[model samples]
Target: MSPLFPALRTADEKEALRFGEHALSYAELAGAAGALAGRLAGAGRVAVWATPTLETAVGVVAALLAGVPAVPLNPKTGERELAHILADSAPSAVLAAPGDLLPPALAALTRIDVVATAGAADLSAAEPDAAEPDDTESPALIVYTSGTTGPPKGAVLPRRAISGTLDALAEVWAWTPDDVLVHALPLFHVHGLILGVLGPLRRGGSVRHLGRFSVEGVARELTAGATMLFGVPTMYHRIAEALDTDRELAKALAGARLLVSGSAALPVHDHRRIAAATGRTVIERYGMTETLMNTSVRVDGEPRPGTVGVPLPDVELRLADESDGIGEIQVRGPNLFSGYLNRPDATAAAFTEDGWFRTGDMASLDADGYVRIVGRKATDLIKSGGYKIGAGEIENALLDHPGVREAAVTGEPDADLGERIVAWVVPADPQSPPTPEELAGHVAAQLSPHKRPRTVRFLEALPRNDMGKIMKRALGNGNG
Candidate 1:
């Protein structure tokens, strides 16, 4: 079997990773990770304090090198959520950067601080036998899902899933060693760690992490030869907002080879704004923790504003029986996860009787196979008065209004309507918000009268997760 990252052995001196002021070449990374892999050789599973740091990257790499399944814990996780993950994964050791202030949740686990060594030569020489697992089916990562429905379940991703997804993306994006990726997304999720960090490494490319996202930071990297930018809608929204007055930022974005958005749908309004300013169209992709990647707008294909493009090579995607062409997205591919760790029933339930994983996302496919995700099946699909409505379309319509800065659409129980659409809106001006009737008229004009919100609730902001996804459950609980 071939190595997941062939560059580690062949291109020893090429720059591999950069986080703020820290950097490591391919050889140096191998040496550093190899040293840690030696110590982790027999470990069952390890937990990584997944900060946007070089050590977190090294720790995960080392665990993969040693054939040990790694669990990445979000640094910002609350005490209860943190404890749940810790107990669920039950890692043998906890990997952290030296001097990292760990929460009480990780106090009991054996701690291993990942430190940078001298060079690749010293560490490589220390363990020539430290090699990646030959079996592609072996578990590589145990990433936990956001427990919106229940306690977070661990999604065990195999080595093949990572390699297959990256290779497919490499082909889709025309990714190469010359391409330098830039982003500041959190490392605990698939978007940042798997694609942002490992994708570059697998392609023999380099990644420049901003540590934290800023308009200035993005401009500096892009102007300094970074070729690609990866971000969620919030980050891109900021970029779109800044491109008007910030000439440097606009120029930097215009110069970028590829601008990609994922984790959540990027509003079409923001998409057009960025394109109008920079002459660059942002690409969107769709995937989840269980499925590394399923669809993406191809670099060589049309850069559609609102649609996530065709399925990757070897992925089979279909809409689960709907006359309107909007249904739950079911996918079957090599990139699919093995199962939810330690939850056999939940794992079994995740897939259909025939084996396709139910993505739990409501979506529609165009004539050309582009995927437009509507919303989550559990929350965003509202059956109101004999019609099925997707909250995402309504939210997009609400966002188009100049008076609305932020918007999330949900459905609440109504005695007459079964479920009535409710719009949670963050007004652009607190002193003068668009009236409920005005916003309803706007949505009705754009889409249909049925899609218009029955009630508009004014809020300072919509509740969001780390990935910038609107938390509708929080809104129902009066937390938003």
Candidate 2:
């Protein structure tokens, strides 16, 4: 097999990466990462402090060049969560940018400060101690999941999983080296690091990170020749809100080749608004930590407003335990992670006897085979009055209401109904918020009466994780 980053081996002096003001050519990046790879020889596994910077990118690339599995640590992680992650994925060393004041949890490990322009050797020649380039099955990364229910478990991703997902995306999105992608997503998650950073590198393309997401930053990069844009629902929502007043933002978006939203379902309201303003339909894709990517709305196909398009080239996907169409999404594909690190029992339980990995996300396929994600089986699926309801649809319906700015849907215990639908809303006009009756009627009219929320609670904002997914479990009685 060819090397993971063919561009790095070339004498191409073209700009390969840019983070804020820092830039690196393919030759410069190759030299820096190669020198670091040589230093990382014999390392079992290294933990990278994932900040949104060039150093973080170089560090992970160096680890990959050395064929050592790199575990990325979220910079904003709390002390408790950080301690738990360290204990769970015990690494021999930690990689971070120079002068970063690391937390106490990382003090026990050896620190390797990553420098962007310190090396002088190209990475075309393999280090004597590094693993062979064809070792596709070797563990390349150990990413930890958000432990919403329990402690976070490490998902062991192999070299092939990274390459396979990127290549499939390149085909479906018509991605090429000419495409210069832009985004301000965090580096720890798959959407940000693997897709945002590694995706461009694998395609021999360029990526310009915003360092921090802002309407101005997005406009600056896209107007400056970035061909593609990546973002979560929250970032897009802000763009949708600003489009009417920000002509530059709208113009920039209209000029781009593609606008992709992932990590959470983009509200149909925002999707429609952006498209109407800029004439660019924002496409959506579906994937999780365990599976890097499964399905996407193909560039060649019609842009379905709500569906996540069809399965990628080699992925086999099916619905399990169907009821009225919606069911748990299960997939088997080369892009899947090997297993949960150190948890053989959990790994075994995560898949079916037939080897299809259970994604736990609930979705239904359209007549033409497009995938529409409903919600997760654990929290978003609500059984109300004998009907299995997906909260995502209801949430989207609520978002369409002019009075509602933000929304989350969940289920609560009820004596009459097995589970009653509850809507947690942040009002567009808090002073004179729409009555619960109005919101309920709006949802019922859009969908069915049974799907309407039996209880409507108002809040300033719905709780969200770093990736911008609404934390439905956090919406309890007192909070709203």
Candidate 3:
């Protein structure tokens, strides 16, 4: 089997990674990561304090080189959640940048300084572990899911899954060694660490990370010849908002080869705004923690605003239990995680006997096979007035209204309707906010009358996780 990152071996002394002003060429990265990998070899498992820094990237790459499963710990995680993860993964030691203040929870474990290990090897002679994993089934990253349903479960991703997903995406997006990707996403999740960082390395391409997301930073990077941009909906939403005033930002975005959004559905409103200003359509893709990537809007395909395009190569996707063209998305592919860590029962429950992994997301397939995700079956699927409604569509409609700045839709038990649609909105003008009647009328006019919000509650902002995904469970929990 080929190495996951061929660039680490064969690429020239060109810069491979940059976070803010700091950078490492291909040779420097190899030296740093190789030195750390040699030290990390035979370590059972290691936890990386996954901060948005060059050290975090080096730590993860080193762990992979050592044939060790690296668990990425979100730095923003609370003490209780952090304790649960440390206990669950049971890493022998932690890898973090020098001088980073780790919480008391991590103090019990031995700490390996990542930056201190750099330049410890001969730069020209440094090479990563040549031996590939035992046929790619070997564990690479143990990523924990956002604990929306319950406690976060670690999804054990294998070498094959990482390489498979990146290869499939490369085919669809026309990703190449010439492409320079830029993003400001956190390094903890799949969108950031796996795709935003590792994707470029696999293609032997360069990546520039904005340590913090800013319109100026995006403009600066893209203007300096970055070909691709990856961001979640919230980040793209900021870009859309800034494009009206920042001509340089719009010009930079227009010059990019590809702009992609994921982690959540980007509103149709923001999509139109960006396309109008920059003439560049931001494509959306669908995937989960268990499934690295299932579908994507192809570079050559029609740039649909709302749909997440078609399934990628080698991924067999099906919408199980179809009713009104909406069903649970189940998939089977090489790009799937082996299972949740140490929870055989939970893992068994996640898949069918025939081998399809049950993705709890509810979506509908168009005639052209484009997947339009509505919402989660647990929270976003509202069965009301003898009709099953998707909260995503209603939320999008509410967003179309001039008065609604940010919107989240949920279903509440009602006496008349089986479950009534409730819109938690951050209005554009809070002092003279759109009333429940006006917002309901706006949605009713856009969509069907039944899809309108039965109750409209105004908020200053929506409750969101580190990834910018709205926490539907936390809605009406006194946080909003």
Candidate 3: tens digits of C-alpha lDDT, residues 1-480: 128888877646777889988888777788888777877878889999999999999899888888889999999999999999999999999999999999999999999999633345465444454333666999999999988778999999999999999999999999999999999999999999999999998998999999999889999999999999999999999999999899999999999999999999999999999999999999999999999999999999999989999999999999999998899999999999999999999999999999999999999998999999999999999999999999999989999988889999999988889788899999988898988999999899999898988888899999888889998998953333
Give a tens-digit lDDT track for model 1, residues 1-480: 127777777636778899998899887888888778888988899999999999999899889888899999999889999988988889989999999999987889999999764353365443545656899999999998999888899999999999999999999999999999999999999999999999998888999999999999999999999999999999998898888899999999999999999999999999999999999999999999999999999999998888999999999999996746689999999999999999999989989999999999999999989998889998999999989999999999999999999999888888898899999999999999999999999999999998999989999988888888887898983333
Cα error of candidate 3 at position 452, Å: 1.1
Among residues 3 or more apart in sequence or in different chains, the pairs in candidate 2 whose N, CA or C atoms overlap within 3 Å are none
Residue lDDT tens for model 2, 35-102: 78888877889999999999999899989988888999999999999998888888999999889999
Q: Using Cα atoms with residue i matched to residue i, what is each candidate's TM-score against the true structure?
A: 0.97, 0.97, 0.97
Q: Can you tell me which runs of candidate 3 are displaced by over 4 Å?
A: 116-121, 124-127, 130-132, 477-480
RMSD of each: 1.6, 1.8, 1.7
lDDT of 3 at 240: 92
Model 2 regions lying over 4 Å from their true place: 118-133, 477-480
Note the Cα lDDT for every prediction shown. 0.90, 0.90, 0.91
How many clashes in each candidate? 0, 0, 0
